[model samples]
Structures are given as structure tokens and as C-alpha cells.
Target: MKHTIIFLFVFVFLQKGGLLAQSDGDNFLNNSVKTEHFELLQEFLSIPNDANYPEQITENINWLSDKFNELEFNTAILETEALPLFFAEKLINENLPTVLFYMHFDGQPVDLSKWDQESPYNPVVKMKKGEGWEKVENPDFKNLKEDWRIFARSASDDKGPIAMFLSALQVLQSQGMSPKFNIKVILDSMEEKGSPVLAPAVADHKSVLASDYLVVFDGPMHDSGLPTLLYGVRGITRLRLEVFGPSKPQHSGHFGNYAPNPVFRTAELLASMKDENGKVIIPGFYDGIEIDENAKKIMEAVPDDERGIRKRAGFAKPEQVGGNYQESIQYPSLSVLGIQSGWVGKETRTIVPDKVIVEMDIRTVPETNSNRLIELVRNHIEGQGFTVLD
Candidate 1:
């Protein structure tokens, strides 16, 4: 009797429109989902091509074009010096405002050995909460696992999002929800490399790329999956320093005191750049960097935990930023990535080297130009009596 009741309840639940129901508020973005569409995503992720694999990259682009054609959308491959970009569009309500969805087809280089599945390019299926499966990896829920998570090079960092978008469109079509707005999808191949070629591509294709607004679907979601919307992103600048003194290496025992080791001099020069408390000694660095009131308000809105963040990050206490994690995320920071000079291995290490190279990167916020920052750093080094060598 209990089994009969359970079966009846399940039947009634499935009868109430089942999994294919679309209400008035149902829109293409959230209302529809298709299993075949998602399987296509798995297939798409199976293509393995990094910046090095030109032939495979072309094949993947062509495959994407065929998929767009199957969806009855116009597709084109925009070519650049590097890999080709795939652009697909379906023009609905010809005069309505168009929103271009930005995505990248290329993925980060991956370590094959560390991959859980056979190949990162072999796309797999992992479901979250039932229905049809999604691509996100889950250690807890392992119900309907398939060899579908594309174990390829560019799987999650980007290709996952692209697949999700297409899968959503496929679902909408299945639910008889043809798009209402002018929809476009841009899949770039060079985004992983700081988008060195995007500016030119955007310029050359400005007419076609013109839109009411641009939506970038990248970066990780906040720890809380509350649908974060960002207005801007920070800029970055890198400085490379090379110090040269003596022409060649000399035995430390013979010329240790006489020869000026470039490594030591480089250390002294770097010391002159910053203080123990993390205040940059460079002049005019903070000249135009007055944080705006809006930025301050945004920073304040972020939650703060005086001690909790430190504990979570395995730190003892607060840092030089004089605040919590939220505030630190809002402020600018300087860090030394690496410094290299002479011997590194188990080789006998009693020689003074002639040259030393220090590489550092700075993350900059708004109103800062890369060229100006470079000039300021160069001037600061020149003021320290060291000849600024290229």
C-alpha cells in the first residue's frame, strides 16, 4: 500500500507539467534546459587545443561554426595573427538593443597527470541537484556521473561557461522560446594571454561589435553564489630590473672585498624603493590616487572580519593595509615576485656574479596609466644614483 501511494504521488508530480512546463514568467535564460544541448557542451570541451595547437584550434572553431549553423544562426570565423575567433548571431526584433555575450574558447594549460578523468578534453557530465547534469565538479554528489566532463586543456576556466550559454539556448528552443533580442556570441582564442589582440579585433570589427552593453562571463563567482555583477576590473603593470657591475664572475676568496657584486648592489637598490612598513619610497606615486567616494562606499559595503580572515588565510594578524580582507581587496598592493642572480643548484657557491635581474608586478586600480607608472618607477631608480640600464 505504501509503495502504491508513493508511485501515485510521483505520477501526479510528473503530470503537473512534468519537467517541460514553461510559465508566463518563464524566460529563455532560466526556463529551459536540454540534455542533448549539454551533451554537445561535453563534446565541445573534448577538443584539446592551447595556444600551441593551431590545427586543432582551427578544427574546434569549425566545429563551433557547424553547431551554430545547426541552431539556424549565422556564424563566422574572425581571423587574426593568432587563432581564429568564432562569432555567432541570431537577429530577433531587429531594432531592439543587442547584448553581446563575451566568452573564450581557449583554456589554460593543464597537467594531464593530475586530471581525475582520462583526458581533460574528453568532457564529462557531473550533475548538481538532479534534473540533467552540469559541468561543475562535485565531490559530494556523485549520483549520475558520465565520462563527459571535457578533461581538456580549456575545460572549466572558460569553455564551461560557453557550453552553459549554448545549452541554455538549446533548452529555450526546445521549450518553443525563440530569442527576442539580437543575440551574439563571441568566442575569443587569446583571452588567456591578457587579450593582447582583443583591442585591435574590437577596433576592426567595431561596427559588428557595437552593442548597448557588453557582458563578460569570466572569473570565478564569489564564495557565495549570489550572482555578482562587477562594474570594472583592475589594471596591471610589470617592471623588470637588471643590474650589471663586474664583467664576469670572480672567486669570492680572491676578489670578495674588491669586486662589487651586482647582486648586493641590486639588493641595496631594491631596499631604497620600499620601507619595512610597506610604504613605497617612490615620489609622485600617490599623487593622483585619491580614492573616490563611490569606491570608498563600495569598499565599506563589503563585509569585514578583523581576526577571522587572518585565521582563514593562516596569518597571525592584520597586515600593513591597516584593515581586514575586504578593505585589502579594495586597496592597491606592491609585491616582489622574484629575484634571480647567480648559482641555483647544488653547484659550489662561492663566486660573485656580474649581473642580477629582479622581476616584479603591481596591480593598479582606476585612473592609473601603465606608461606613467613605468616612468615614475624609472625616475625613482634614476634618483638613487644607479645608472638606469635597459
Candidate 2:
């Protein structure tokens, strides 16, 4: 995935006159990816990027600063409450439009026991063999295969794109070429943790971060392995609901019927939020969202393999939220991410749990207000004859 994206970036740059002619650009791209690009990715993937470790994040920032500096980019460390973000800019011409690119360096926590390799930070090359991947001890970069993969945290999530961007710049520099637009980059250091500090930091550095257009180099490529461009993404908000029962757990045999089970209450409240067809039943949840004829035509033009999606996701029928897969995402959705009431499996208990906790998330579109949706959910809870508390 990393190499493929790097090729795409360089190819686009060539078309945009940021590199030599197509013939020369093709040779340069191949050589750079096999050599410089591969080396950069390996070095980057070696860094442990779990945001929980501030020291590790600092190390990544240092490395990033050095790389950008080497490319003659003006770099700065944008300080935030938790951790600092890495910023770099290259102004080709003040009169030209500026394009801001967003990528992340932070990765999720790793479990050593779960990984097949020595460490998740150590990237490994593998090739598909039967039903599993077989490690390639020493990959021959000169003869890399299409199916070969480099496995590492953040390799694709973000760091891969960063390396690709840098590689493209290096190629342009070698060819004495420049882009048509000025460039600004903001790399997040805490993206895996929901980027709690990103909004405030952006507000604080609004002038420096200002740009004519913003391009986020994140998210998966289209399933068809074609170049994809997304115009909009769904905004997210979270909610936690707790149903309280008795102060302490009681033996199920002693008060199974007498003591109120918060689990049942939670179930009832959750059930009211959605119908069997999986559409949110809350009043005004779907308000202000409308798909016109043109939007429908644009959505239907997407070659989404509905049957393939259903088979891969292991579902017989999809929710009737929209006419098809593309139409479904246009509306807001309420999803229950997790629920915990009592122990199960080997930890099963013969007592009624004291409380039930449900964690949910709401994906909103442009027409909806996140705070308003949250209020509607809270009101619905209260309407269910339950006392709601923040």
C-alpha cells in the first residue's frame, strides 16, 4: 500500500509539471521507490509512535523536523496542552494558492504477545502464502512483488504518506523542479486517541495554518484499488449512558424478580432509539437531511459492490436506512459501540449487576448539529422515564 501510494503521488506530481517529462519521471520514480523511498519508510516505521509515551512522540517529531529541514522546508513545533504538533511549509510563490496537507504520526498501543514479529515497531516484509503471510527474511527491493506487504503500525495509517511526500520533494529537487502551489503540512501526534487537542491548537494557530485548500492524506483507498477522492466525511460524537440499579449486587436467586435489573432498563432505552430495520427512531434525528436527484445520480455512479460488501461483512441484509449503500451514509446514524452489565463466559456471576453502562457514537452529516443530536438523545432517555445525568 505504501509503495503504491508513493507511485501515485509521484505520478500525479509528474503530470502537474513538478517533475521531468513522463518518460524520465517513470524511471526516476521506480529507482527512488526501490531505494530512497524504501529506506525512509524503514527508518520511520522503526520509531515507536504510541502517543501514551510522550518521549517516543518527541523522538518522532525530531526525526520529522530533520527530514523537513533537509528538504529546505521551514519547520516548527506547534505546542499544545498534551503534545506538540509538527508543522512544515515551503513557499514557492506568495501569489500562488497554498495547499495544506494533514497526516498523523501517532499509532495505537501494541501488544507484543499478539504480534507475530519481535516488535510491532520493527517492520517486516511478508508475502501471501496459502491462507497466511510468509515472512520474507531479506526482501530483494530491486525485484519487489506486487503482493508483498510491509507490516508495521502507522506504516499506512499515516507515516507511509509522509515518507511518500518527502520522496516526491526529493525527486523534484534532484530534477530542479518546483510545484505550482505553495505547500503547508500539519502532522498530528495524537490522532489515534481522537485528537483531543487538535481543535484548540488549530484555533490558536489559525493564521499560520491558513491555506486555500486542505487535503487530508488519511483513510483507506477504495476497495477497487482505484484512486479515490472524498468530498466530505461524517463528523463523530460520543455518548455514555449509565443505568443505575441497587447500590450493590444481590444474589439472583434471592431477588431475581424483586430487585430491578438495570440491564433490562438499559435494553429498553436502547431499543427505543432504533427500530428493527436499524433506522434511528428519535425525533428530529433525520431532520434537515435530504438527498436530491443530482446527489442520488452521483452516489449511484459509484461502483460499490453491494454483494461483495455484504459477503465480506457477513450480513444477510443491510439496514433500510437508505435505498442503497451509498444513500445510507447521507443520513445520521446512532450506533451502540459497547454495552456492559454483568460478567459472562468464564466470569459469569449468579448475581444481578449493580449498574449497566452503554457506550454509543453518533455519525453526523453537514446538515446536523452534534450538540443538538446529543440533546435529542438525552431528551429521549428522559422521556423513557429515566432520570438522566451528565
Candidate 3:
């Protein structure tokens, strides 16, 4: 009996020690919710940092800089030839690999009518049911489930992830689980504006951003509730292609047959770009787009229930072709995002606009390049007997 008890004690001791060792790796946060920390988040959410409001945006950047400084990080404000960029570093060793973490601080403009509370910035806490949210008076975090979410401008879209990452890091520091790689946190102010200046900024700061890997915490997960690890994103190229006929607007009534209606010509040009099944009708559009084994495997993992997807997107039918969510996103597409010419409003109706401006964008897949796609588009337009002007 004595020997059996001793053996049981030894087994228990080793089992418990093994559990602790495994848990030491996940030391970022204790699974406890501290409401006080949320107070600081709410306070930060109240500050306006609309990119259009440059002065207020600067103030917000300074506040974020102060936050890094408070966290004992070596913080610096870097410029990207456009808006200011904040780069904060916390290095444990000089020789360690670096992980560049990216996120944006700016948010979309506020629409007061859509807000639930009085103001989007004056966050209010209210309760009526089981789940809770912060009624962000600022209205940054839209699509909120409750008053616990602030709707100011960029709440969940980005600022929420930014806060979560930083807070997690802070907790990790508190727990003494040092980062394996050198850390670089970059906060951009113009991501919502199509990140026009970001690519150039990254190229210029290649040395400063030299890192083993980059972790971009943007966009959301799949509606199927699966934890996603995106390898790459589809690149976009936007251009305004115009077909000029005459010098100025002509009265369609005066020269119905003789004058070239640019609107009709524009319609014909766009119609030839895509088929009825929504596939890009351009020749060679699908060239070099062979689905690799890995991509096929990843896509096969996606759920294929029409009911579930419809319930999530709040629609009965899929948005694009190829029958599933994965195909719609994976394949390349050419879409005329916007088209404007002449007057369709209340005041104007008689004139045939001479110049038709069609703004189109093409989303490219991995095997394709944006420049080559642009070349294809320009070629297609010119081939259809239309004058091409960049």
C-alpha cells in the first residue's frame, strides 16, 4: 500500500508540471476580463482622428506615440511622403528576427443618422439583454451587436485589432514571456483611402522595415467562423479610360444619327469585357492561373452550404460566379466600379456628352501582375476600335 501511494504522487507531480510547461508558451493574457482596461480603450475611441481632419489626426498620432512611450518602447514618428507613420520598437536582443506588425489608426467618416446614440463619440453604456456593447458616441465601430461597441469611425475595422494586439503584448510583458522576434509596430493613417501611399512608403523604408515576416491584421475572417490565415491578397489596378468623340456636348435631338453617343460606345466597350456568367471575357485573362495543390487544399477546406452562407451574408444567392465564396475571392475579376458622363439629374437631359469617362478596376490573383492586367485592359479597349488615353 505504501509503494502504490508513492507511485501515484510521483505521476501526479509530473503530469501537473508538464501542463504548466505547455501553458508557459501561451502567456499573453490571463483569461480574466478587466473592465478597467476597457475604460482606457473607450477613452481612446472618443478622440477623433479622421484623415481629412489633419490637425486632429496629428493629435491622435501623438496620443498613440505617447502610448508606446508609456509602454517603454522606443517610439519614432516616420513620414511616408504623405501622412505621418508611427514606428514603435521593443527589442530584447539585437540578433533576433523581426516581425513587422501593421495596422491603421484612421477610420471612415461618421454618418450621424446611422448612429444609435446622440453622438458617435459620446459613448454610452446601456443594457437590455444578455450580450453588451459600448454605444461608442463616436460611431467608429459599426455593425455592433450592442452598446459595448463604439461606433465612432474605425472601431472594429482596425482600431480594435490595434488595441487588442498592443494589450496582448502588454500582458505578455507582464507575464515575462519575452517575444521571440524583435517587434516593430507600424500604424498607418490612410489605409481606408486605398493605402495609396503605403506601398511607396514600404518600398522607401525597406531598410527600417527589414524583417523576417510581416503580420498584417486587416480585414475579417470568413463568415463560416473559421480561423483564417491568409497567405496573400488580390492586388487592384484602377484606371480611367476615356473614348473622346467630339470637342463638346451636342444636342442628341439635333444630330441623333450623325453625332456619336459616347454613352452607347462606352456601354458596348464594357459589355465586351465580361460575359453573362460574370467571367472576364477578355482573352488570355486566365493565362498562368493554374490552381496549385496548396491553394486547392485550402479552398477545399471551406464550407459549401448555401443556407449557412446566405444566412451570414443576409442573402439567398451568392454575389459572384463559380458557385462558392472561395472561388469568388480567388479568381481574377474586371469590374466597372463607376461610370459617369453627361447629366442624368433633374436639371439636365438634352445633351449628348462628347467625352465618356469610365472608371474600372481589375482585381488580380497571385499568378497575375497588376501591370500586365492593365496592359491587357488597354489592349482590349484599343482593339475594339476605341482611342486609348491613359
Candidate 4:
């Protein structure tokens, strides 16, 4: 799938100038997306890129600088309060419009015990075999198949695209072809951490990062396994709710009927925000968001396999927030990312926890404001008789 996307990307660039006939371009691109591209991806995936570690981010930035410089791009390290960002550019002509491409090298933390592979950084090529997958040892890149899968952290989420972008540029350079627009690339080192420093860094380097257009090269390919271009995406805001009860943990046996359990209060508060249908029940949470008939028609036109989605996600029923998958995301969504109270499993204890902490995130559409939605949630909690602390 990665190779297919890369081939299409190169093909589009070649097609712009009518450089090669369809068949010729196909053959050339097939050869271009060969061992070299795979090797680049493998090398990149081998490096641990958890943004929590500044050292790891530095290694990735160094690697990126070297690769971009080798391709005749001038690269710089843009410093931020947290980790620094990487910027590279190739000026074709001063008159040409500058296109800034955004991609991230940082990935989420990995738990080794949860992964089936030896290591998340150690990428492996595998082919599906019935219900399981078998590793393809020393895969013949020349005969790589579209169905062959690469298992690794950040393989698809981001690193794959970065490798593809570089490979595309390499192919163009090999063919003595240059892009019509001046190219600028920005690689984020802390994207996995919600890009806390990205805004300030962009503001600090506004002049240097200025471009006629910005293209974000993140996210998965369409579920249809076809090329997709998204015009806009929902914004995100997070909330942490801490429900308090007794000042200290109390033995359930002693305070069974005396003390209140923070867990129960937390659950009740959360339940009030959403009903059985999975729609936010809080007043004004979805205010100002309305999908007209024209917009609904456009969303319905998407080729979404509702049943396939349910089967893949292992859910029998989906939230009734929207009529279909497309309509659902068009409205703001309130989701509980994680919740914690007392220990369970092997660490279970018969005690009432002092507090219950719930982490949630709200996905906001254009019509909604993140701050307003957050305030709405706070108000909703207060309406349930829970004091919301700053």
C-alpha cells in the first residue's frame, strides 16, 4: 500500500509535464519504488522516535537534515520551547509559489509486551496467512505485492509518507525534473505530544516558514484504499476531570455505606453527558453545528462500508450521533480517552479510592469553538453538582 501511494505520487509529478507515456511512467515508477525506498523506510523505523525523549528526536532531526541536504535542500533546525523542529527547502525559482509540506517524525510511546513483534522499531514485512500473518524474510523488493504489510510503529501514521516524499524527490532528481513550485518541508518533532510547541515555533519562524499554500501529510489513507484529498479536519481539545470523595482511601468494608465512592460520582457525571445513543446530551455542546441537505448529500456520496467498519472495529452497533459514518464526524464528539480510580486486575484492593480521574477529548468541527465546548462541559459537570476546579 505504501509503495502504491509512492508510485502514484511520482506518477502525478511526471504526468504534470507529460514527461513519459502512461506505460513508460508506470514501468519507471515501479522500478523507482524498489529496495532503495524500502531501505530508507526501514532505516527510519529503526530509530526510536518517542517524543518524550529529546535525544531520540535529535537523532531523527539529524537523520532528516542529512537526507534533505544530500538532495540539495537547505535545511535548518527551528528551536522551540520543547523539542526543535526541522525545516528544509529547495528554491526552484523566486517567482514560483512556495508549497510548505508538514510531516511529523515523532511517534507515540510503545509497550513492548503488547506488541507481537520483537521490537516496534524493528520493522518486518509480512503476508496475511488465513487468520494470522507470517513474516516474509528478506523480501524480494522487486516483487513486492500491494497486499504485503509492513508492521512497525509510525509505519503508516507518518514515517511512511516522509520516506515516500523523499523517494519522490529522489526520482524527480534522477530524471532531471524539477517541481513547478518552490518546495518547503517542515518535520515536527513533538506532534505525538499534541504539538504543544508547534504554534509558537510557527509564529517565531513565520517569515522563514511563509508559503503560498500548506499541505499536511499526515493521517491514514481512505478506507477504500484509494487516493483521497481532505479539505478540512476536526480540531481537538482535552479535559481532565478529577472527582473527589474522602480525603484518603477508605476501606470498603468499614465505609461501605458511610463514605461516597468517587468512582460512582465520576461515572454518573460522565453518563449525564451522553445518552445510550452516544450523542452528547449536554446543552449547547453541539450548538451552531448544522448539516444542511446539500452538505448531507455530499457526505453521503462517500464510499463508506458501514458493515466493514463495524466488523473491523469489532462493534455490533455504532453511536447514533450521525445517520452514517460521514455524518457522525460532522458534529462535535465527546469521547472518554481514559479513566482511572483504584487499581484492578492483579492490583485490586477493597478500598474506596480518594478520587477518580477521567480524561476526555472533544473533537470540534468548524462551527464549534474549542473553548466554548470546554466551558459547556464544565457547566454540565457543575449542573450535576460537581465543582469543576481549574
Cα shift from native, residue 49, model 1 (Å)? 3.8
For model 1, the superposed segments whose C-alpha errors exceed 4 Å read 1-42, 110-155, 245-279, 292-297, 303-319, 329-359
User: Which lDDT tens digits does candidate 3 get at residues 1-390?
Assistant: 111222232222224334122235352233323444455566667888678888867987888888788777898877877788778988868877788889898888787888877776655654334543433243323222332433455666677666666565555455555655688988888776667788888888888878888988777645554445678888787778787756888888886788888889989988898877678878888787766778777776777566776775687655454546676777778878678788886868787788878777888888888888888888998899976655
Q: Give lDDT tens digits, candidate 2, residues 168-282.
A: 8887787667788899999999998879899999999999999999999888777677888898888889888889998999899998998999999888889999999999999
Using all chains and alpha carbons, the TM-scores for the candidates as numbered come to: 0.72, 0.90, 0.77, 0.96
Question: Model 1, 104-169: lDDT tens per residue?
Answer: 887766678786666777765443445434565542222223323334555556876676666555
lDDT of each structure?
0.66, 0.88, 0.69, 0.88
Candidate 4, residues 72-189, lDDT tens digits: the string is 9999999988899999999988988899999999998999998888999999999888877889998988787877999999998799899999999898877667788899999999
**Relative to the unseen true structure, what is the C-alpha lDDT of residue 9 in candidate 4, on a scale of 0 to 100?**
75
Clashing pairs in 4: none
